[model samples]
Target: MLPKGFQYAGVYAGLKDNGKKDMGVIVSERKAVCAGVTTTNLACAACVKRARKILRRGAAKAIIVNTKYANACTGKQGERDDAEYAKIAEKLFGGPVLTASTGVIGQNMPLDNIRRGAELLKKELRDDYDAFAEAILTTDLVVKKISKTVQILGRDVTVAGVAKGSGMIHPDMATMLAFITTDADIDRGLLQRIIREVTAISFNQITVDGDTSTNDMCLCLANGLSGVRIDRQALPIFQAALTEVLIYLAKAIAADGEGATKLMEVNVTGARSLKEARLAAKAVAGSPLVKCAVYGGDDNWGRVIAAVGRSGARFDPEKVRMNWDGLQSKTVTINIDLANGRESAQAWGCDLTEGYIKINTKYN
Candidate 1:
């Protein structure tokens, strides 16, 4: 079930040639505390630029999204278009709207179509989770969403998230597009801090082709509908629930990577620091050679070792040890030991296959 104070809607705005649902919005029953993490690419999209500014206000009533025209690298007009779209949404659905978009990077958004979509969405808002999840996807094979309820202050506090990503997925700020909603009352600064910390170990740990998108972002809203107030004493429970939702969606994105047949997980332990462990884990997971070995079931452990060595993590080569689950399964895990200290980290990616080559050759 969705969080109590939120409503969703998805409709076709003619941005996509396939006539699929390409536009969506999530509206909270009242003003909600909002937090967001966005792409670090210098050439990021207009939506990312605008959302960064809006997130600082720490409050919003709705989020409007569209796919099939990223509105990136389009010059000043793109920024104007993104602002205009938000204005249209605010005009119809009230004030303080955030926006997100994905798809081809250089095209300008169709303002007229977006206006029509906003008008339709005004009358279509409902609790149809699947519809909004499906609308945000581009190359994803299936919808990715999760909901969990935790006990907080003797009340049921719900946290829910939905994500969309298939290609151009790597983490600098956050990967692709994800939206989270919670019914727990939370401070805006605390919510932002939690999002950043969780994203580092979740979305920031996944890779698909190692190509970070120009429009990547993750946003969270807390409307306090559950009447459960979160303070330092109760923060752990709420953060843990949010972590579960984000990590589930992250793994879903990796497993659904374009033309990928299996998920590959890398675990690194016994490092001198968490940063070093993370560096080692991500190095192995993002290595195309290691991914190809997993795809072919080649059992080539040398590639993994080579990646770790070049990963800039300090560790003695003689102390390193490796183990692997059979590569033939739908999920493969690689275990490694730096044998240096107690720090550890994990990363996720998908096996590289010939299908990947085929899909990208005509991606445009």
Candidate 2:
């Protein structure tokens, strides 16, 4: 079940030509503690710019999103349009609205369509979680969402997350639009720290394409509707739940990437540091050669080793051991032992296929 005190709505706003739902709104009954991680791409979207500002306050009441026009690289007008979008959402939902946009870059949003969409969203607002999940998608084949309940201070707290990413995904602040909500009362400072830490091992551990998108972002809101108060002692439990939700969504995004037919998971161990372990795992997972090998069911173990060598992780070639399992299945798992230290990390990615090229080349 979804967290309490939250309502969702999704509607078509002419942003997409096929009459697909392209606009979505998420509102919390009251202001909620909010934390966000956004794309580090220099040319990020206008919505991302506004989102950063909103997140700095550590509180938010609603989120408004659109798919199709990324609203990136559109100059001053794009920023103005984002401002207008926020004004409209704040006017409807009260205040402190986060904004997000995804799809083709270098395009401007249709102001009229957004105005109309806001009205439709307000009128249709309900507890329809699926609608909100579907409306945020662009090329994603399925909706990504997960919910879990945990105990905090003798109360039942819930955490739920939804995400969308099919391509242009990489390990630079998530590389997708992910929204997570919870009903636990959490210190905003602690929540922010938790999100950043969890993202490093979850969303930041996945890659679809080597390119990070201009509109990537992840937002987490805690409304305390469950009456569960989280203290330092209970932080670990909440963090684990949040991690599980995000990792599930991350794996889902990798599995459904563009035209991917298989999921690739890499495990790197015996690293001198956590950073090195992450670098090695992500490099292998993101390597086009490794992905193609997984796609073709080839046990090209050398490609995996080559990726690690250049991953900026210091390691001895003689001490490294590798194993590839399930290469012929829908999911391929690779294990590597650096045999140098105790640090380890895991990364997720999709097998590269010809269909990926076709989908992107024909994309408009």
Over the stretch 1-364, how does candidate 1's per-residue lDDT look in tens digits? 6799899988888877777898899999998999979987888999899889888999999999888788888899999999999999999877699999887777788899999999988888997677889888876788999999998878899999999976532112223899999988999999999999999999999998787878999999899999988998889999999999999999998899878999999999999999999999999989999999989887788999899999989999888999989678998999999999999999999998987876777553
| Quality of model 1 by C-alpha lDDT | 0.88
> Clashing residue pairs in candidate 1, if any?
none
In candidate 2, stretches whose alpha carbon ends up further than 4 angstroms from where it belongs are 167-175
> Residue 235, candidate 1: how far off, in angstroms?
0.7
Candidate 2, 1-364: lDDT as tens digits: 7899999999999888778899999999999999989998999989998888888888999999988888889999999999999999899998899999887777778999999999899998998588888888776788898898887777788899999986432112224889999998998888999999999998899988878888889999999898878887888898889988989998999899877999999999999999999999999999999999999899898898899999989899988999999978898999999998999999999998987877767443
* Candidate 1 TM-score, C-alpha based: 0.96
Model 1 spans with C-alpha error above 4 angstroms: 168-175
The Cα error of candidate 1 at residue 263, in Å, is: 0.6
Candidate 2, overall lDDT?
0.88
Q: What is the lDDT of residue 70 in candidate 1?
A: 85
